[model samples]
Target: MRVLRYLVLAGLVATAGTAVAAPVTYKLDPGHTMVLFSWNHFGFSNPTANLGQVDGTLVYDEKDPSKATVEATLPLSGLDTFVPKLDEHLKSSDFFDAAKYPNVTFKSTKVTPAGKGKLKVTGDLTVHGVTKPVTLDVTLNKVGPHPMMKAQTIGFDATATIKRSDFGVGAYVPNVSDEIKIRITTEAHDASAEKK
Candidate 1:
């Protein structure tokens, strides 16, 4: 009985010694992150718009990918389509109503491995005062120290599609193409490294 008790205690000690690594938090590098979206314009051609100055955080653990989390914000007031007038129109009440709802955001609920350095991130996307669930297909571009910045960084490319009407931005709907394709290229610097 003493020998059995000793064995159980030893097993418990061994298990306690094995600690799971905590996820590392990274802050989005605004200078290296971009959010671009495209939609069919009257079926003539696809036009694209860009949202500048994105900010976010990503908590990830490569050893335990399921622990990954993401939160991002995009200011709709910074929307640009190259054409100044069209840019202004997009922010007007007819479209995004940027004055009323200035920012769009996403907070991940689940992170699932999708094979080959890819992840399927399911999250809540809030836009124009509406919140909807959306999934982004993400591929890790690279992870390491940046040569120029000398900071630990991780890069990823993600894509998703959403219907504008679903977010109450349906002014043109069928005419302007309700479906919008979004592509994001992001680089994040380790929060701890940023202090140095």
Candidate 2:
């Protein structure tokens, strides 16, 4: 009976060890979370551009794989294609129409952990009154305390190739690349717990 009791206690301790979770949260470091998009104008030439001001949160469970999720919003008015005159034109009804639909938001419905620190994030992407299924190819670059802010944060690089025309940004299609490559360099920390 003594031996059996010892074995049961050992098993319970092992189970408790696995249940302890690592601190994980990703607060969008707006200064570091860059939303960039690019397309080919004619042939192989790819013109790249970036948008400013993306806000969001990324929650990760290092021990429990099923509990991870992401939520973010990108302002449509912030989209910049590098040309100042063209930028103004883009905000009109012919394109993003910032006056009407001002923001693009994403909320994750599923997160699957792939080996090599990658995530297959399936989520709803809402743009211009249209909500569609979008998946972000997320690679967890690093997860730890921030050197500058001194808070726990996770760094990731994500990409999603989407069609602007699908969201009714259909003005200059065929002439412009139908496939837009969107890239994000994201650093996330917990909003309530982060110092900076």
Candidate 3:
């Protein structure tokens, strides 16, 4: 009977360990997450646009970071180029055609640990009704309790270069530059944590 009791206790301990090592779900904080992209214009200068109001969730496993996954959506309505006419023109059919495809989205298919606090995230990016595979080099900035929000938060900075022509947003191609550089910064709060 004593031997059986010891075995049961061992099993319970193992189960508890597994539970503590499981993945965690974190919801992106829209107010703290933003996407920025820049493109070269006729070899003269580079123009940037900021996109906000991102909605997404991230499933992260600190014990096994390779299993992490991320999905995000950015509405075109939130895009700002700091120029009203430029923003309107970009949303028009000449560019993104926001009336038809109003949002840009990305869903990770695989995540690989690159180095200390770094990951290579490969995902499908949908833009202007076209979907393409893109890889983002991501660096984990920090993961801890937020000072103001009073919740556990994880932050990351990611960057990627994509060709606009490949996504069917190829207006003025070579003139406006087909390649676009994208940078994303996000802070996600643990969904299971209570905010005080």
Q: lDDT: which candidate is best?
A: 3
Rank order by lDDT, top first? 3, 1, 2
What's the TM-score of every candidate structure? 0.88, 0.83, 0.88
Q: What is the number of backbone collisions in each predicted candidate, taken in the order shown?
A: 0, 4, 0
How well does candidate 3 match the true structure in TM-score terms?
Answer: 0.88
**Tens-place lDDT digits, model 1, residues 63-127:** 78878999999998678899999999999999888999999999999999999899999999999
Per residue, candidate 2 scores C-alpha lDDT tens digits across 1-196 of: 9999999999999986664455356678888878888888768578877777888887787776567888889887677877887778767888778899998889999988877788888999887778888998988898766788777677899899999888778777888877889898878875656655
Off by over 4 Å in 2: 1-23
Which residue pairs show backbone clashes in model 1? Answer: none
Error of 2 at 175 (Å): 1.0
Clashing pairs in 2: 26-188, 26-189, 27-188, 27-189
Candidate closest to the true structure, highest TM-score? 3
Question: What's model 1's lDDT at 68?
Answer: 94
Which whole-number lDDT from 0 to 100 does residue 177 have in model 2? 77
Summarize candidate 3's per-residue lDDT along 1-196 as a digit string, tens digits: 9999999999999997897577878999888887999999999999999988898899998889999999999999999999999999999999999999999999999999999999999999999999999999999998777998787789999999999999998989899999999998999998877443
